[model samples]
Target: MSFSVNKTIAQINERIRKGKAVVLNAEEMTEAVKRMGKEKAAREVDVVTTGTFSPMCSSGMLFNTGQPGPQTIKTAKVWLNNVPAYAGIAAVDAYLGATEPSEDDPLNKVYPGQFKYGGGHVIEDLLAGRSINLKAQAYGTDCYPSKLQERVVSLADLPYAQLLNPRNCYQNYNAAINTTKRIIYTYMGPLKPNMQNVNYATAGKLSPLLNDPLFRTIGLGTKIFLGGGVGWVLGAGTQHVAKPQRTERGLPLSAAGTLMLKGDMKGMNSRYIRGLSFLGYGCTIAVGVAIPIPILNEEIAWFTGVDDSDILMPVKDYGRDYPNCDFKTIQHLNFADLKSGEVEIMGNKVPSVPLTSYAMSLECANTLKSWIEKGDFLLTEAQEAIPAG
Candidate 1:
């Protein structure tokens, strides 16, 4: 009878031991699960929580309860546990078909991959204050040319020819002015003339001539004289030899009696004819005097004047207006009406919680999976029973 009683007592003791072991294991498992939950919470909070997006908890929690409510530790604990489970299920559902093994199959026996959280937030921040070089992209070129040169030619016969014959000047001056303006406007920014389209070389050659001091100084009458008969005479006169005269009397001698004229005679005649004879013989003579007029310099000065007086002043005034135009001046402005604490999220003001929550969840899940594979925590009975374990 005593042996029987001893045997029965031993059986009861064994069952108690097993039960104790099971309870201890269950508690450890719960603690591990809770640790994972806390980690996930922290990650999600880090990723999704922004100063702008933080749920204004005037009551000391996420939701708005104006009274400064009491702390409920139990409620928080419950929330922590539930969030992970809910997140896992939601993730599984969201990535239903995309997973290698279906969501319904089983939890992954293998550990998680690397954590990939906060990427979405990083991307959002990058996009917020970004700028781009639009001119470089659009024009496939650099900045505008700051230096430019233009020539204004005052033709001798333009006005008179247009008045009298009209047909002599085939090119319309008005049309030419308009076209030149268009060219100036078109090439106002950085532009390269298409040599293939026109005689860019001719334009280049004319540019230097336009900048010449003599060209700018020459008047209409001077240009007419230089370009017309006078020019022809001067060119032809370089080779002309004056015929020497021979006379019986003490007068101008005949050709046979007189000495040969060594220097250019008709050239001197042409210069005299053109009213530039005072500028000595064989001197470098430019008929139509050009003067360099700095068009770009004048334009830049004008632009600078406008900027200093108008643009900069107005811009500065606009900036100052922000500080001067305070709400205090308005009679209806009331401080009490402005409820300071977390205002209701609505309309366009409602913040888009960047996909940080989802990303962090993925990271947490991956971390948990890694811990489990690394044997950081013991598995369930069913999991332990698997062949790989």
Candidate 2:
């Protein structure tokens, strides 16, 4: 016998009352599945925590830098650390994206701007309680007559700076390599030529959506640890493509589900969430997210038993350009072989290292476990699974 949402919640609440609810992180749940099997594991483990720490370029933050001047300023332009914050909104409200580079960055003459101090880095500074310079301009009006405004601001001075990312955790990702004899700078970090290096993302076996697979227990309104603070799965993210090919185990062979999460940037820890400057490339934010999967049924338990071998991703040759690059020919390999630190590609043994931080992912998972143990967090029934596209 297994459980429904209400039944599982009741058991969890009762256990909490007795100060003995069983909680396990992804790694622990995987082990419990092997030792106790699906049935026992389903009944014994209340929640399974999953984490990912990687650069999510789709991330951004919205801030309420309160009206600083006596005259209302309908900000026509906004800049935070040289990065343009979208001023299309109201006067003092703007959104800064991780990948958004500054206007002055192009003058550096690099093919790709090394946005060392862009909006992403600005967020890190704000979290660190460091003062960041903010400048805005608006044509003077009859009532709201404010031509220009500028100031230094900190997180404490604002109402809240919310990190609302349209796409955060990707279901899966490619392990990239450059076959041509030329060094390339792409989003997956700099690629050394002639398959000299392989950079892979994704938490592999420990990824959240992969653990749930079919989105059975991960959906809208599901509470998650996002950017070091609690957030919810708002809805299906852009390009949440339910791909055609999937393993017999039901996990996608390509990137499938995506998540849009938002949380208060004020309460988040700077350590788990960070910003980066890719030397010749643009800026990116390394966001940490954790999802707690409720073991509501035997099917859920079966899904949670998934391992590195069950998850596979493409090894793309980034040397090609445009539409051809989109349809580039390559092999799909299991995360198990990728985790081995080497993979045989075209008879050439290539060394592979994860650009994403698995160690930090584990730490994020463990941190969520402590929250559950301390009764600081509780699971909410996922509103609805991500439907087939």
Candidate 3:
């Protein structure tokens, strides 16, 4: 017997409101497809949610400190907890990026994971309701007489706070290994000499972009779970390669698509928005993000059913290729091999570790599923599709 099934976002939202929508995480969706076949699974499962948590350097927050008076100040410079924030906006608005280092950081003396405080830490402290030292400087003007100001403020003190990340949730990333005789530090973490270990990031089968490879379900204005709060997709992220080399299964072999996201920081949880510092590298934020895929057709079901073994990743040497901006594909491997503890490289087996947290990803997926099941979350049609390559 042949099966033909199709659904719409409106239909799914109605089913969710009536407490009849069948939702599953990406992992469960993969199994359901395998057991019942693609067409049947597509007809039965209304949604497949995915999640990922990892160090994303292209993340930051924008906030506005309430003006004390009309003649208080027109800010020309700003710092939060001694970390410099971009004050090019309105009088009291600033943007603190995740990779921005502390003003007191001695860059030359910094080592891997040694430099602790940065923009990421500041953001975390604010989210936890901790007071931060706020300072600003400006030349006195006719309407704003104050030249400088200093105070202690928490998240509540700020009239507005929004997390606006330019790039997050990389579709797929490279697995890094060092081919040199000395240890090297990179955004992927420290790689030992001569390929002793390899590092990669992604939630594997549970990654959002991996589930929606063609950018069909997730697009501009689509709602998502971000840092334990609700968020929306702004647009295509910086360095977004819409069309990259792919396998027959439509999985990219290297870094491909990305996302631009924004959310209200007041509602974010600190656990899902963490600060991280790498030895010999810089500081960044580890963000937890999740997206729900509405199964509108059989094709989307097949895309979400991809397993770890079926997806491929390009192996690159961080010590040489990465530092030189050379994207040389040293080898090709799969997440199944990496997660199994080790992978073979040049006739030698090397231990592999994932920088991305699969456990946290699973937790996020379950959280989103619960929200949908409780009728607290509803699907939205994308106002505009993300640009496809």
What's the CA error at residue 169 for candidate 1, in Å? 89
lDDT of 2 by residue, 262-333 (tens): 889887988877888776677888999999888777678878888888888888887774216475548887
Model with the higher lDDT, candidate 1 or 3: 3
Ranking by TM-score: 3, 2, 1
Q: Compared with the true structure, what per-residue lDDT tens digits does model 3 show for residues 55-104?
A: 99999999897786645887889999888999889788889999888877
Ranking of models by lDDT: 3, 2, 1
Weakest lDDT window of 10 consecutive positions for candidate 2 = 1-10
**Clash totals, every prediction:** 18, 0, 5
Superposed by TM-score, candidate 1 places the C-alpha of residue 271 at a distance from the truth, in angstroms, of 94
lDDT of 1 by residue, 190-227 (tens): 11122101100001101111111112211222111111
Model 2 segments more than 4 A misplaced: 1-7, 105-112, 321-325
- Give the TM-scores of the predictions, in the order they appear: 0.11, 0.94, 0.96
Global CA lDDT computed for model 1: 0.16
Q: Model 3 TM-score? A: 0.96
Top of the candidates by lDDT: 3
Q: What's the lDDT for all of these models? A: 0.16, 0.81, 0.90
Please list the residue runs of candidate 3 whose C-alpha ends up more than 4 Å from where it truly belongs after superposition.
1-3, 106-114
